[model samples]
Target chain A: MSEPIPLLMTLAYVAVALWLGVRARGSHRMDSLEQWGVAGRSMGPVVMYLLMGAGSISAYTFMGAPGWAWSKGVPVFYVVIYLSYLALIAWYCGPRVWAFGARLGHVTQAQAVADRFESPLLGALTSLVMSIGAMAYAVLQTIGAAYILEVMSGGLLPFTLNIWLVLGTIAIYLFISGQRAIGVTNAFQGGLMLIVAWTIGLWAAHRLTGDWWFGGVFERLRDTHIDFLTLPGGLGDMSFAFWTSSIIVSMFSFQQPVWLQWMSADSAQSIRRSASWLPTYYFVILPMVVVGFIGIFSLPDLERADTVALQLAFQQMPPILVGLLGAGTLAAAMSSSEPYIHGTALTWTRDVIRPLFKLSERRTGQLARYLIFPIMLLIVGPVAMLNPGNLIMILLVGLGFAAQMLPAFIGLFVWPRATRTGVLCGLSAGFIVTALFTVVWPNPLGVHAGAWGLIVNLPLFVAVSRVTRPASDATLARFMAIVAPRRPTSRSAGEREPTSSTIT
Target chain B: MNHRLIRPATRRGKALLALFLLVILAGLWPAVLLANHAVLILGLPALAAWSCLIILASTGVMLLANRLLPLPTSITQADPTKAASGPGERVDE
Candidate 1:
């Protein structure tokens, strides 16, 4: 149980990740913004599947879900519910997004929305809000990775050093290889995490309760802490209303800027195929949740609930398994963080900077490549070191903000009648209401603030669109022609079908 | 099972959508309350067991939908020239 074994194992994992990233750069020339941002839209189903699957299940799954299970109990199962729906949303939306990106060259989500409504100001606004959400997510992962490293090293690697180390590794590869690096590294990390999660989960359960199955663990919990098995969980704060609202908000929040880049696969079919299989990955959460429950009895009175799994590993498991757990947790954190970091730079430069300053595409791409450093070192690194909030709460807040972009999504993919003004007003209102309720009033009447925001947002959006002027017919036709094309009329059957060029 | 009654693809899509909604409702407030007992089913709590069942159901439906629907044509075919140049060139602007 020497400390050096765990530290060496973690360092080896980091080395492997860097190797995969550098190797991924060998396949493509990272010249353009499209290449750097979305891997030149050339990713196939396998890479896209692993990338999207791993990206969506982040440090939140490894740390926050276990933390919530340890602290609040069954309410943590809300993550399971929302994640299941997230795949369904991806199945429905991924194809449309891929089609739009392929046909129109959209590397970032804001670019598509801006073009749909023909409003650069809306694009800039969307970029700003999405950047805030992205930063929150990155910071959350950073803190989780640092904590794991510190514990696995038996306090040899301090949190401050670990935080910089985590960000530095991500920055180097992300700067060199971009989305290609993310795709390769995430695939390896994704496979590693699934294996490590199951091993730790079953081993922990067996060691704690003398059974590999979770039924015994639940039975023990039910007899002693009945509240842990039901809604409004152990803390009595996660009421049914809050749980339901959180699920709904999380479903919409799945459409983060990074996901759009992930969906920029070589074909719409690859995206859809990958999405249909993505939900199965949610099985990874079950084992992590079990680890958390085991912690309730095995490691009671832990200071930080998020570190319960690692703490338990150190106390009971052999040093090898402890080192493996450390590496797996870091994999989950870095897999999620790389995309957010890459997406943030792409969103800021392409959607915000380029359009605002009228920069050329070449210039924008170069700037985005360079912007990754300051974003990681100056912004995400410092905030993560400060450890601003709890793991799950930080995740929820970011998703709530990202969920405000629902109106823009409607304009892009579903309702063509949605005007620029309606989306602008609705997004602004939703963001304000969500922020106020989240920070000030804070989940009034046991309903999540995001749900309250949406309750106000939808009606206002519809009412405003009913009165305001919608997008120009050409713009609307351009979008409809891509997402929902008309069946060809007999008179026009003989002519060349109207492609993206017709509207333009 | 009833291709005569409805287009198989459309029916499958509807069924998939319906199953998704059912999972959501089953996992939420009123419906979840029905299974919120400490009672164990197959080595897990009632609600935990229910959540796992729905997750399995969700994966099954998605697989069924993928199999039923015809593979869509590549949308990239609409703009071969732009697709070849990579997704860097601005089409509309």
Candidate 2:
């Protein structure tokens, strides 16, 4: 039966993931903190390439994107544009972050901030912000993975059971091996995701546009669903400003805990190599888009638009591959979730608990390990089962929260005047305004609440920093040397060189 | 093939940076109204194709800029321990 084929494939995939996690502890002595936390900061181009690129593409790319395409149409293409911008951002920020981490022995994003500004309090707050986003993201992945399992299995699997099994499996693998396991599995999962997305997308495109195989449906959609082809979003669900603002926010929103993965690479060059290939990966959405566009024509009466992609695959594709599709979707979910859970654990140890208690590195790592399960079980697990809204909603809110950290980051390397008070004040103000507009105020002038919040956030950062005492020159010289020079069209000697009292 | 991150020094690299900024700016909130068009290209509407074009162009620019960086060694990530301790390579104001 079709049911068993997918279920069996999913189980096989789980076995490989577990095996990869166990074997990930190979050769490398993970006794040192960097080794365990960041795979010794030694991942080469191939591994780093897969790890960073994979982090950007989550199960949402497979699950929620198609649903957006099915309902909203042309706006879904924003996924490709935003990811392309994210890659460009890495080309700019990745090297600098890696340089700071490599030079300062910083393993986490918050550590970089804490060291730069000489404020452990700021570091803790930054990590807390990132942790909140990660938990939401992890839960989003859990819900997505569960949805794929339940939907693909034709009700043979239930959402509640699927949640426990998926989260439990992810937790075990992450707890055992840490970042190394994630890097290895990402290579496998990233490759699988690309192939599966291409196969299904191209196949669906060919089938749906039958007789007019190349793109006959284009003309047909123009005739009928013109609104779908034109944007501001289908049926005016999203305005033009919404699409544009979302792209700007999402592109720069790569400031999540995954910056740790950037630092884990063997060299900044590896991160650069990966960025070059990232735009191509964004094409994975092309197939998802094609499938969703077809679903608009084919599966019109479905209760939930999110179910369209899975339904079409089962209806049109052979039964044997449906299970494989289920597994691939699960891969998308796990690839992202594992890192988030680990990132949360690290943040708890490095930023919050360690700073307060002054624990040794080993003890901190132990405490980090201790918190992993409770985070998964008590927080992410519950939210996944009884989510407040759909997958995209949670994801958007998480992204908005992540974006709140950007001003602080930009200040760290770009402007010397950005003080601790400035960053702290700007961050809270931005978050409050964004949260208010996003949840409470609702449709603040038809723009994304985050966009409106940024209007308040950027200026506040600038104003507060101007009035506050700037960082000591020694502090600025060390952190600014790498990234300050990278800024386009800026060639000041001061920006390129450090103040004399520092390392030089 | 050169695995280096981008920098802005040379005329070519600066131009590439300009192109990247121009394109990204063109895609912001004000420009979204212009992007919403009904014309079709290979089964997608004009707006969709426009987004694809922006990404493709930006990728080309990024690749070009990275390839033109002055310090190849600086572009590559350094080993953590040496990087942390080595003051000789550190910049002097």
Candidate 3:
């Protein structure tokens, strides 16, 4: 009774996730590439909403979020600030993805852009860059899962085995069941994580104040020179820079492979339905901040910030609850990792294989499967060996690079005159600025480099687009129809339902 | 097509659903006080009897809500064909 019951319960949660994945695999329809990658584009609003929401709230939600709360105090709440804005983006960006996916037959973000640009080379390049970056990010997640396992088991199992088992199981099951597995699992995982996250939050709040009032936590937070609840905590150089940069940069930049989940929705209304609720789902996280505050007081001398969640659960909560926390963490990792691997395979097949070889539908599907194993091996080994240092720097760099895709997607939607050359130039400029920001300055001019780069990137897109000759009227119309408010019928000059053979 | 849910379906249905779920979930923990001869389970100062009841009840309510809620129509997915051809055009299978 003295020790927490986290271990046994976590094992049970793990077993349930694995069993669910196995059951989903039995019902899998892997004959078509669409089923394999995009979940058959039949997902309804509730499922789509949960998958995307769970997908977004990954190891980052479980560990990184609480950790950020532990270290930065209240300021980390800035991350959740975008929930509403992100929902807005989903409302707008999601339906367009569906429209375009239906018409252009897109399976990945790379395809959406390449099809719009009418250049496989552009598609290939975008896919290559995104795949490389996303693979690294996936590895980060695998490492995160392993780290939690090591702490939860008290070193009974090595971190490396945990990484291999967790990641390998996810990849294998995903390869078997594809997006259907991901959707169902994400819904379950999202619900579980929500329960666990709030439970910990409420429990911690109750402990500190002997009630659920915020006064004690707020007072304790205010006592910290860095009250995390406020901005510009007297860190003149870093605070303002981190806050403004993360908000703007993350808003514009983050283009993970899972954005394609919008395309998998059963209908246009599903997009809006999912969008409406998904952002509000973030309300579960306020308790996480309370947990972080408790960590500040409860485990005053912890070495690593990420370990805060584990330490608190083990040190304070009952065992069954700890297991519940483990289940939540595992859900975050799996929901995110399954989509990443699925997207990696899609990117590899469409961006790399198709452009160079011009493969047929059947062959393209085969090669995609071939690509998955190597990508798995690529992440599992190197990520396990690397220790987490300067995580904030890594997160910032990833965000900056991801932001570059925004200009291209936005341009396709709004500016009919945006030309291929202009897009190329805009992408180059954004990438160069983001790379420099990520590498050289890390923090420059008291602001996030990605935000600064995006400021620079936006004008270049507009300037180049206006100056360059627009694509032919027909090409422009084709692109516009996808983003148009009304759905295009076959009577439209150029409209098509997606199939296995679409080049994108 | 009424084109909206009961009462014109303000754009906030999804958000409100999530909010409602949270309140019910949070209330479950405190409901431990409602149980008789409160016995501790999992080392928490709560009743095991109440905890299991709350879990089953919450899960049941969610499932019922899901079944009862009306499904929104998806326009882009209804694929019937008018035969025509263009580059990158969608075709019905």
For TM-score, the strongest prediction is 1
- Give model 3's TM-score versus the native structure: 0.80
- Please write out the lDDT profile of model 2 over residues A106-129, one tens digit for every residue: 777887777766788888888887
In candidate 2, which residue pairs get closer than 3 Å at backbone N, Cα or C atoms, i.e. clash? A6-A323, A267-B77, A268-B77, A498-B93
Contacts from the true interface found in each model, as a fraction, amount to 0.32, 0.37, 0.04
Q: Under the 3 Å rule for N, CA and C atoms, how many clashes does model 1 have? A: 1
True contacts kept of 2: 0.37
The Cα error of candidate 3 at residue A10, in Å, is 2.1
Chain B TM-score for the candidates in order: 0.63, 0.61, 0.38
Q: What is the per-residue lDDT of model 1 for residues A441-497, given as tens digits with 9 covering 90 to 100? A: 989999988998888887888779878987766666555656655422222441444
Name the candidate, 2 or 3, with the larger DockQ value.
2
Q: For every model shown, what is its TM-score relative to the native structure?
A: 0.91, 0.91, 0.80
Give the Å error, residue B13, model 3.
Answer: 20
- lDDT per residue for candidate 3 within B1-93, as digits (tens), equals 000111112234344455434424332223322432222333221222233333344334333433443322232543312112245522111
Q: In order, what lDDT does every prediction score?
A: 0.77, 0.73, 0.63
Question: Model 2 misses residue A92 by how many Å?
Answer: 0.5
